[model samples]
Target chain A: MMQEPQQAREAFRGGLRVPTSGCCPGWTQANLISLPREFAYDFLLFAQRNPKSCPVLDVTEPGETSASIFAGDLRTDLPAYTVYDHGEPIGQRTDVTDLWRDDLVSFLIGCSFTFEAALLDAAVPVRHLETGSNVPMFRTDRECRPAGGLAGPMVVSMRPIPAERVADAVRVTSRYPAVHGAPVHIGAPESLGITDLRSPDFGDPVRVEHGEVPIFWACGVTPQAAVMRSRPPFAIAHSPGHMAITDARDSDFLVP
Target chain B: MMQEPQQAREAFRGGLRVPTSGCCPGWTQANLISLPREFAYDFLLFAQRNPKSCPVLDVTEPGETSASIFAGDLRTDLPAYTVYDHGEPIGQRTDVTDLWRDDLVSFLIGCSFTFEAALLDAAVPVRHLETGSNVPMFRTDRECRPAGGLAGPMVVSMRPIPAERVADAVRVTSRYPAVHGAPVHIGAPESLGITDLRSPDFGDPVRVEHGEVPIFWACGVTPQAAVMRSRPPFAIAHSPGHMAITDARDSDFLVP
Candidate 1:
């Protein structure tokens, strides 16, 4: 009796409050962003300019509930939503029905979850998935290409891949440009201004064995950082790790 | 001693008015779109939803003439621009200096010129380039996914590739997703509602040899068609085959 939309509805109604990382094996997951109609253009332009950091998966018309890839309403479908006001986290709630407005626009962005499945299938180790912890992320010295009023330093997520298999990792991930694509930096933490891999800005660090190297990819958290820095009047995003599950298959994002 | 910007400046000043197909080797070429600030969000959303047909390369801030990729002013840099009013072409001019406004936003989209070079470099024959004619284009029965206020049938350009070399052609073009990446259809023209290979809705039809299969790619003209169909009060686009050249190389758009 639990069909796709029904399952999502269950999550919307508070029957499911867990992180969506491995919840649905083959479905695509998306990072969420919501803002007033006045600021949607600037936010979208920022994503267009810095595509690697903010690879937009789908966008909704102002005040519209559903998106191109998902059937459920945007306001309450996700398990949790974080509201931000003037760059400060106001609160987290199971539903935003009270906050929904006629002038709000929603944006769904590609998440690393889509490519992690590809990496796992290729036998490339996803350290965080194996350890049951979040992927380690860092704030880098590199500045994302700015657009409109949004501007900030690029943030990246790191995974340890065997040195010999690094080429294979690049090849496999390159096929999925929708999901942050390939590694931005390979084997050099110093280049990205991350001096100590043990101390990350976000998430827990994983082990890097003798034959492995740290590979960094542009993270979806980037737009969040930009929103925090720019401090628009109001904004909303899915709580990290609790993403919006879409009907699109993982293979749909791949290129030749 | 002429540099990259100098070439486009000369074109802006009326020294170059020909089709930009083979103008500067190795550089990137882009489709151009300009509109009032209010419609910018909708057009960008349309491009995002129907990426294959409208692969956005770069977008400019409102009232800004230069974009991230191009160094010259968009108002007069391109050799020719077409002005549209209520979905009808009103005039074609060498420059739109007199029509410049403080609220117009310019968009630079990826053109097929980038991938055509890759195809030729791989020794794949381009019939249009060889025969001195425009690539054959058609308006298909296929409808692009609607976004905001823009909606239209997807337009595609056809190239007859030798049956044996079809895979090679696909491999070469698939690397350039920034441009229209791979063929959306192959072999059967009827599948796309085209009854005659000898006739096309736009551009001249090229000869299809006995062993060649007609491969179709999503065309840059699609956004133009969508804009016209949407009937925005005002719009500006580059004249067909007259593109905005950029400093970025074609290889810059290629994935691993």
Candidate 2:
């Protein structure tokens, strides 16, 4: 069995530079967002206001690459990094050691992977995971509360749950509030301004079989969407589906 | 019955300068902290790390007094304000409008009052509340995980719960993680370095009856303790027990 910290250490040594999905079972996986010191507070406040979309797991002080909560190095532990310049992707690299700066701050945000684990444990079928494709993500018409220079539409990931099991899906996911808990929308995609479920703005669309209702949960990609719209001078984020596996158990975040 | 926002507006009009306990029956109350732009990031990081002590409810951008989640003018809506200089409280004020600066960032943190309500609802007796005295707060040997320039001993408030009902108290309070959540210490104050159950570092002490266990929870005063220890050039906070009444319901913060 692969140990959690060992996996991160392997990634740090450049041996594991692939997506972190399915690594460190029962622990949380987090999305990474890095920005300059000047924009750090704004992004933090944005996450606070839009908690459903951006549940912050941990934050690093400016010039600090170590995450105290997750207990890992930000610069090298993750398998991949994507750097953006003025809202546009400049490049992707295996390690961000060359781009590290004293003015930079990083955030570890909760990913939907934890909730998917809960759904599966509760016997709620997760379509994308079953089909071996990326979960479909869409930009919603709902406007997120703006914070300083960051603002955009709420982004959601959809899963088609059997109509009889939607309540179970909601109940199981609601226990993990730190990982984008509960369904934000159910049974209606057009209300969120999604024109077609077959063609999503991100990820692959899965089958919405008969007797199933499409349920959407707030997505961690919401921050990336906000950053792309706001276009700070410099920013770094984990590539899509590449997350930082944390040592914290999914049960650790569950509320009574 | 006085409405929640109306009560806050009364304080804004300079007519209500009393503790906010029992003022808004169902709404959440928040502790206020205002710091300069330079120290804002550090305090935010500090709160993010010690969540049980400082669960952030809302944060304002630099120079902004309005909180979107809690909703109010940070300058005058609170019943009282305390100004600290280099970690020393020099004065108390009804309004900080004249002292407001372009670089100040305000943070609203979760108050223990929310979870106390939960305890009461669960048929658990809150000793201090029953005695109509301020909750007994003590500084512990436990060091908060330091963030940037902020670090200090974790401060906790003690409650005397009957041994038979301690589990019920924990189960009820754990539902509100935005508040202090569950007890950090139970039955033994000595383990937390408290020698006298009748003496506390802050607030009034209450009696521990026979068959009752002294339960401890991380307190909001923890940030004040850290701020005092750090000694920043300037800081502003709500006077203890005088909180900002929020529009959010205590139920809104409850988890499954």
Candidate 3:
């Protein structure tokens, strides 16, 4: 069924723009990006330098409607998206709605599913889904490339894998670098320069087994790291845990 | 030299900050992080989630004077640094003498040298030094994990490496996870959703040889990506070419 972005957005109403991650269970979820025209070139350049932290999905031409590669319309595809002005949350509505601009650019990026399946295939249990808790994250001593008016830190999402499975975990996850492949830091938050595990930087804490080591992956939060410090004038994003589900699947991004 | 941060800053005032890379040589060349207290937690959390983009060097205790890691002091240390408030450049001062705040928190994190040396050891040539230009960067269709109230796209830096050296580059670099390790994306800008390579998103463009595939690494600029989009009320950082050099060395962080 080829439904228009606006029509798809309208169908969900207040319920639409919600994360489309689960809409198509087997499909991948992507991050959404909306930016002004002035910083477009620089921002695009920045993303290229920092792929793991900023996996590029689909981009739209300035003031254009459709995506660079993926299908669906930029203005109406997602059921929900947020709007920002001068780095402040001005509103949240399904679709870009009245906020679309000639200078605005849209981007979609791959999520963690590509590697998760690999982990699952390797029989490495992802603790969060088992316990139904959010993965624990910590700020480490890592940095990302800076460009234009963009700069800040790198973010990561950690999964607690069993001690015996750490090697397999790394092997499996390394296959998909597009959606954050491999662990940035293996164990000991302090080694990554993290002090506490109970208090996570983002998301809820997941249970770490007694012998398990915390395996961290570059998360989709690198952009958020910049906003908290620099506070760009305008930005919009999907709500936490809420993501855009793409027509693509995890198997599409495997390196092997 | 066991000099204080402020004292080290004084050295830069005497034309010492020039060619600042590896200035303290072995010291940690940190990407300065200064943000208003209102956004402190979110940013601290943002750094936690996107450690690669915003690593936690040493965050100044709120209203307290001094950093906990990397540098001995926040008043000064690096050869040079910059400050930004509300998405505008107020000034680039050798010392943050006039703008020091009780609420401001300073953060220092690991830099790429920890991994760059690995690349060099593996015989990977870094071109920016030869070309005397900034490493080219671009935006990617990627999203970092969101923390606090911050979120946006990912930014990255690029280097052209011979295709044969790719495996070595990944292997050598992967040993140092503290700094950005491993190539995020290897070749084909469009594959990562990047449309251009000559016109970078951040730094100056470097040369790409006939057989050299563009080898990209996670950059320190990812945080700037979020900062620009979120536009926190107040923030400070090392100017594009400037960094806070700490008491660190590239060899100290390698995995055996």
Candidate 4:
């Protein structure tokens, strides 16, 4: 039932601060955002324009608490939830059971973790999992198209792929367009405006061996950056690493 | 080069009344909605949920005038315009050159005429086009989930598919997701809540042969119906027959 995260979120609602990954297997997860209805068009437009970084999965009808088109229950599906108001974290809730509103619309975006499983399946080393650290993600100078007030630079997650398996990395991951698709930048960190592999704007750093080079894929965090820049009167997003679990599988998103 | 609609809109703005379709081919076109930002989330969720009816090709950032994303000068993109305020058509304008607003968000939706062209390429006969009449459409009993406050039934366009060639008919049309990919209700009209094929809620009726079955596909009119049911304070949709032609080629939307 993928109940660990659900239980954790239940506890988180009571108060828990922890990243939830590998906690739910086979249950597809999502990046969460709840904002006033006024921002829906711009946010959806922004996500459409910048799909690699923000592949929208399902958008809940405004005022509708449950994602009727996607699944039956969103409140109990995720392990926990984080609330943001006026562009700042208010607090974490296991269930948004209390904060639900009729004027708010929720957006579920595809996450990079979907493809990470594919990488591991293809025999690609996911150092973050092996070393117990989050995948290194860097902020790039590449400017995403500014939609309305939502505007910001792109953010990318990096994984060190062995030189010999680099082509395999692209071939394997390209099959999954719903989860960031293929690499936006590979081999050179500086090309993507990254100065060093040791330091990442978000997430913990992982090792890059002499034979391995950093490969970057667009991250779900990009639109969150845009939301932050716009500083809407109210906005919400998933906590850095916590995500909403869903029923979708890796094969569901494969482009081919 | 695409100045006919511009001239027509100019005439309408200067004061003219006429329908717009085939006025300009090599031009980008769209359904115009000028609503308060509050309805943004529901409308977006509605469109996302009902893509075949509201297959969004482009959505402008919030509180903006021209559809900078897909349409450059919506001022003269089409030959005529309909301004609706609270589910009622206000007046006809050739060019909404003066009606632009920062609070208005424009959306470009895929028109089925594109698929008719594709069908023509495959030698499929388009009955409505042959008879110089609109394709027959009916209101189905199936209800679309209310996004925000927008809620209504699904509307479908019906075509008489020769029983022998139903497979070919499905194959030829299913490729274009942009133009309402595939038929939703293949044979039975009653099953879709449509009782009669000779009379339709919208569009002109056509004859069905002895061996032909009435096939139903989701119609673009579904959005207009949803808009009408919701009765937003203000909205603008493409006039029933007039469609916005896009820069995209039909082949691009063809599914393998």
Candidate 5:
């Protein structure tokens, strides 16, 4: 039986710590990041300027744990979290209830997992999912638009698709603008200053078959990258692949 | 001869005060609203929650007078501005330079003027444009999703389209989601709590011809309505239809 988003969140709240890739199949999964109130404005402005890389799903008011999209307690609902201090990952925890502060502002960002399902449903192969590996992510030469004190290079995830299915993948994913939308780069990674396909900056490299071409889409990890570089005094983010499964249906973000 | 966005701003900077309709025809015009840094987060969140009512085009840093979308000095560029003290209109000015402050954050919201051109291009008759009157806008009974310190009813602008051409209007305007996309209600004004079409809360009402139906789209004046109701300590907005001409072209916002 497929677990509902609430059930999955309950399990996590009860201390189930694991990656959330295939959990709650039809529901939307989101990347979670919390920053102190002092830095929330700069980060929000940064997301506004670089929308493709940082498609915001929902934002919470200061000290609030839940948003309209995710009704569970944000401090304990996710499988795993990384606590950051001045840009360095200080530690990982299953829950951060004790460390949560009154001035913390949480942001839920759209994740590509929503569109990967769309791609597969449209018969476009998602290599990473088939191989049971994390998608390949790379830091590119392109700099994101700077806002206030936050700035960083854009990070993108790559998927290998048959040349014939590239257009179909673009069409299917374009409908979900809330989740990174269409390919940022269709082919030739070097144009974006990506030197080697085998060595990605983050995640596992997947097999690119003979007829397959590498396609890139803006990654949700971008805000984390910015946090890592900008080094704000305090921040919290979901562990790389462990996301928060929200109550929103996949079709909610789809546009006609 | 047509004026470029820069040229239009130059004229406004030189004290040309008038409604911006039909000015810089192909360029996009945006509604301007500036508030103190204290209220910026709540308003940005309000916009995020109610995207249909507030399609953000660009937002400037506190004290910053320009954005990438609008390159001219915001303090002196727009034709006219309305200053508010605790939400009550205090005065109107051609240039806000004397009143500008470093902690003031400005938001550029998408205007229906962009999609109105698209409607005209699709051969949909725009009654207000034809009759040389302002577009009719009303405060709907429906409430917008509230954010901290900001809450109000949704506001909509009405245009009467020939019954047969209503579908075409929706298709054309839906492509420009940055501006208010598609009509919220079609045919009946009373359904939206608007008792009469002759008198509107804002703008001059136009005659609805026979065989035509009234269509309502989310209006750019919404943020102003929110400001009026929320009663922020200080606020500045474009004098109704007197907007800031942006460098972005209408086609820039059209999605496939």
Candidate 6:
């Protein structure tokens, strides 16, 4: 068990490969997305326009490996990375040092894991955690505001909470706006054009028990969906569920 | 008096040049800084690093005439614009339609005016508004975190609040973090390297009453200071005290 974010990053840097979900319990985890400098401005605009789905934590200068939030070398620090060629996944690798480019710009986006922790702390049960499965994510029919060449449906991560605890969940997560914040939709997945709750486009679907409501929050995977739909020349992202554990604590993002 | 933000923008678009202070009272005002595309990423990163000094409200795509938050044409909507050539102010114009370039990227940053209104609403006396003087702004000794070719000292706006209402002023302003937020310093002009209360680097000085304490909040003018020091080849900004009245309501920025 990694006790600190730096320890987790150091282990990853030394060639250890593992998902970062439970590591460094109180620290914040970030979603990674790197793109060529040419595509950076448009993507930044996309994140700015759809802030709920793509709450940015840190953005590096073109080709810079380290951001203020994460001091490790980005090329080798993450547990795993998925490389995309014109929106198609070309390969997944534990280290991307060989593929590093000076013109590539990296964005560190806030992850729902931070808010999930808050939800759990508030006594709102997280279904996926109990079942030991990935949180289910779906592509909604709603279109995000287009920016330059990027456009796609908003992707949302869903969790099952007791109907009575819905308000508590919203209150807990609302304090972490840097992370997805509050639920985008509750109860009716069909309203978002999600035909079936058991079959998600990304991540594993968890069981929805009796009296539990399906609540969805804007997912950080949103930018990846945009990348796939828009087909940027090249891009890279952390494998779903695998994240960069940052030095910042979950409380660092909590608003008063 | 313009009753709506659009009306104020229309008046400016029609060449009515005047400071935007007190216009569209319930609307949010923004500080404009249009830079060539070459400087966009660095400036964006600079804003990310120094969020308090430069809270980005909206960023337009290269050469975009308007943003979602401000539906008016950027080239002619603002009351006045100061064009800069290698850091020096070349001219102030009512319209920049002729100088508008395809690669110019505009950043609409949060202005202190929004929180000032909040402060006034909370019954926290604002000295500048009472005296009909521009808020005094000073370049502080503290340097903002530099980002890729942009480096300069932080600039702060000073307000004199009654010593008893300082806590109320802080609470009211803190609710609107998007607009410079709470006071960065309270009751100490000399602490920020501001030599004298009467002599400010920018804007007009106001009298601090016997029972009033001078409070300082991060100012939007910090970016202009960076442009001056970094010497970017070209830039455009709102002339001092003249702002771009945005369509977003002041309430839209209030958190919690």
Docking class of 1: medium
Q: Which order, best to worst by DockQ?
A: 2, 1, 5, 6, 4, 3
lDDT tens digits, residue span A1-256, model 1: 2225448656666646655655566778888888889888888889998889899998888888888787777778887878989878798877888988888898898888778878888888888887877778888999988777788888898899999889999999888889899888998899888999998786687898899999998988787788888898888888766678887888888888
Better of 2 and 6 by TM-score: 6
DockQ of each candidate's interface versus the true one? Answer: 0.68, 0.73, 0.03, 0.23, 0.56, 0.49
Clash number for each model: 0, 0, 89, 9, 0, 0
- Kindly give the stretch of ten consecutive residues in candidate 3 chain B with the minimal lDDT sum: B18-27
DockQ of 5: 0.56
Candidate 5 or 2, higher lDDT: 5
Backbone clash total for model 3 is: 89
Task: Put down candidate 5 lDDT per residue, A1-256, tens digits, no spaces.
Answer: 2369899899989999866766787799898999999988888888888888888899998899998899999999998999999999898898999999999999999888888778878988888778777778899988999888898889998998999999999899888888888889999999999999999987788888999999999988888889888999999998766788999998988876
Candidate 2's DockQ: 0.73
Question: iRMS of each prediction in angstroms?
Answer: 1.2, 1.1, 11.8, 3.7, 1.3, 1.5
Please give, for residues A135-166, the per-residue lDDT of candidate 6 as tens digits.
78899998998888999999998998999999
List lDDT for all candidates, in order: 0.83, 0.83, 0.64, 0.70, 0.87, 0.87
| I-RMSD for candidate 2 | 1.1
**Candidate 2 residues A1-256, lDDT tens each?**
3457656656555746655545566888888899998998788878888899999998877778777556767777777778989989888777888888898988889888777777877888988878767778899999999988899889998999999999999899888889899889998899999989998876788899999999998988888888889999999888766677777788878876
- Can you rank all candidates by lDDT, best first? 5, 6, 2, 1, 4, 3
Model 2 has an lDDT value of 0.83
Candidate number with the higher lDDT (2 or 4) = 2
lDDT, model 3: 0.64
Candidate ranking under TM-score, highest first, comes to 5, 6, 2, 1, 4, 3
Identify the leading candidate in terms of TM-score: 5
Every model's TM-score:
0.92, 0.92, 0.49, 0.76, 0.95, 0.94
The Cα error of candidate 3 at residue A238, in Å, is: 30
| Deviation (Å) of B38 in candidate 3 | 2.5
Better of 3 and 6 by lDDT: 6
Compared with the true structure, what per-residue lDDT tens digits does model 4 show for residues B203-227? 6898998988788878777877877
